[model samples]
Target: MSATQSHRGVGSAVALPPLSNGPHRKRLGLVALIATFGGLLFGYDTGVINGALRPMTAELGLTPFTEGIVASSLVFAAAIGALSGGRISDGWGRRKTIILLAVLFFAGTLVCVFTPSVGVLVVGRVLLGLAVGGASAVVPVFLAEMAPFEIRGSLAGRNELMIVVGQLAAFVVNAIIGIVWGDVPGVWRIMLAVCALPAIALFFGMLRVPESPRWLVEKGRHDEALAVLRSVRSEDRALAELGEVENVAKEERESQQIGWRAVFSNKNLFRILLVGIGLGVAQQLTGINSIMYYGQTVLVESGFNESGALIANIAPGVIAVIGGVIALTLMDRIDRRKTFILGLALTTSCHLLIGFASMMLPVGNPIRPFVILFLVVAFVGSMQTFLNVAVWVYLSEVFPLHMRGFGTGVSIFFLWVVNGFLSLFFPSLVAGLGITGTFFLFAVVGALALVFVVKQVPETRGRTLEALEEDVTTGAIYLVHKNQG
Candidate 1:
């Protein structure tokens, strides 16, 4: 065994070995680019609706209640998608699962682009939702399983970057189409159609990428796992890593009581899964999607004209992309728990400030909209910078290799469900409660989320997946990092 040095934290010392050295940067970078196309599809499909919805409602003769349903339909389907996709990826392998998602993306976009009725359009959105949910569940794990421990954060976080970039693409596309062809019937279809080109690219691109080696080992394909590992790591390191992985897989198989029953029967596995669920639910409760989904309405309610709100909506998307970039740079450098806590803190504060500003400023004040907009943008920046990437990375890493997909799926299922319900009822929420009330509600949730992170979330930086897996399987990973510096 490698020599270990004792690192002191608040009340204990952890003798952690050095993290695995990074592997071929160029090889891994290319793999990330291919995998993250799923994220792009995710961002575009969800966000295109942001700008496209206003025109869509007018064309479809949608009631406000129906508007919420149309918006939430994709999200509800995404919940199912994340659940099913997680299980599918666990069985089918991550790379193949992603390829399937690409096909769904293409078909979903095509359906939405041509749908003449509300019913058909919803079916398309649900298809797109499946693609989005699958991408969200699998891409991070794909990257995580491929990455070296030392740089896993940055490498895995590229999916979040791609997601936000896709969102930004939607915002920009919606703005262009809205400006040039705003009055044209079915311009919204053009916005939805933009996703199809990338889907084709994703399908073709993934054909050349390798499957996750850890998953290969889990399936008893040791030789195949070694072969995949060699392309990403030095030959000697690849062999060493394979040896470690084989040992774990053997222990898991020997223990062999797996499935939902096994997961619950094992206390450590169940506890960690709950933490993952908490993280997922907490993220959505921040209310970030409300802005992404109903931003124009929020902006208009804050006083801007519809045209101006469409243009101004781009600001949050721009900040989201920029925040994603900054987040990618910081992931490997910062401890995961701190980033999460800081994100929740900032997000919560923004909520309170937004609520307070809206109340004090009231309606019709020229500065009220601008101030609330600024706070909302600030909240988006905080979330994209700290919360989004870290939460995804944490979900990818916390589960045992045997159950990574299922665990992440269940957690994210709840996340998407929370997101869906919020999206579904947000128009109602705003109408019932208005900006001040809605924001204060977010503020309350944000405060509780802040506490959850500080008390429950574990730090996962600078640790090998294998090492983390060992600790997690034993319940030590949770206890060790819960208070560690």
Candidate 2:
């Protein structure tokens, strides 16, 4: 059968036009929003600890090293979750994978909220970390697969925006909870429990959402896949998409091997995997997580009282959300490479300024908190505006469709592993070198990342996933080979 004929008649049914109307758009948005609640839980579980940690440490008698362990335990678990979530999503389908994540989210938070010992707390955090890792990997892929190519960036971009919104929500909640019941014996429990609400919402909402059509095609449920496609897209467009998806799924099946080993054996796939991992690692090195997980601590160390630091910590969250809003508007217009380079440059400058100010400000000086706080906010703004959305979008889009899930999972696993170590050792780094020394290290990493982004990253702002996959998998993107071929 010809390509056009096969697409026009799927098995035996006539191809219908794609749906592009109110009901379909609303359903798509609702699904995206539900999956994003996992991001919200991720942000809150991680960010709430920033403010809650001080009081929790006092109550639980944690040492600096132990503090690092406690904070990083979740991140380490998340690495495992990220590594595994992709394979699971591939096997189980995106909707079911996320529904499972919701269960983990609720259960993990419940354990953390009531834990009496540090060991138990660590266990709970590890569980939460797994959920976070899964959410981070699956949410973007699910959105990218479901969204139309024209709005794919914005729709997939929405998950990252939701993550920051979740982080901001955590910050605001911490501030309010810390102030209203400041002297309560277990105030941090309240901060942690707040995530339960979102977790429940995610699980219930996902029960009603449709499974990803791509997953259906991969599983050889072609008619069901076409039905799903028809729900969101016009019938003709949906059939066209399903045909393309079916073709790629067939290619993947013929390849018959998909894993880290296959990815490494193909030198070009290796390069793409490296780029994905590099982007994840680079995104973390910007030190944005430091703020989310320890913003209040950083502010206090900069010389503010508990009350003042709690209040001041909200600034970055506010700016981050605003930057995210701007990013949504600009994502379609901007080049991915340029936005990434710009983010690295701006964030690197912020790190240097922060480190310099910390060194220049004498202990007990009034200006120190204000200066460091401003710089921190600047860093968050730069990251939210440029790197966060682009990194996730690129990682999701850069790989051949055959390896998208496994590749993203591997890259994100290493990404979270690096983040785990950083979170674990950050306080020690601060203790040994002070804030100036700490941020100075970030500045060095940022400079290296900027060089990597400008020289190696590809532009992916306005291409369909099929187009991108074809270009990327064939080595068409590298300038040296494009004309030679």
Task: Give the 10-residue window scoring lowest on summed lDDT in candidate 2.
Answer: 1-10
Q: Each candidate's root-mean-square deviation in Å?
A: 2.9, 4.4
TM-score, cand. 1 vs. native: 0.95
After superposing all C-alphas onto the true structure, candidate 1 shows an RMSD in angstroms of: 2.9
Report residue 81 deviation for candidate 2 (angstroms): 0.4
lDDT of prediction 2: 0.83
Please give, for residues 217-250, the per-residue lDDT of candidate 1 as tens digits: 8888888999888787777667767877787777
**Which pairs clash inside model 1?**
none
Q: Write the per-residue lDDT of candidate 2 for residues 437-482, one digit (tens) a residue.
A: 8889999999999988777776665555665665565566654223
Q: Estimate each model's TM-score.
A: 0.95, 0.93
Q: Worst lDDT window (10 residues) for model 1? A: 1-10
Quick one: best TM-score, which candidate?
Answer: 1
Among these predicted structures, which one has the highest lDDT? Answer: 1
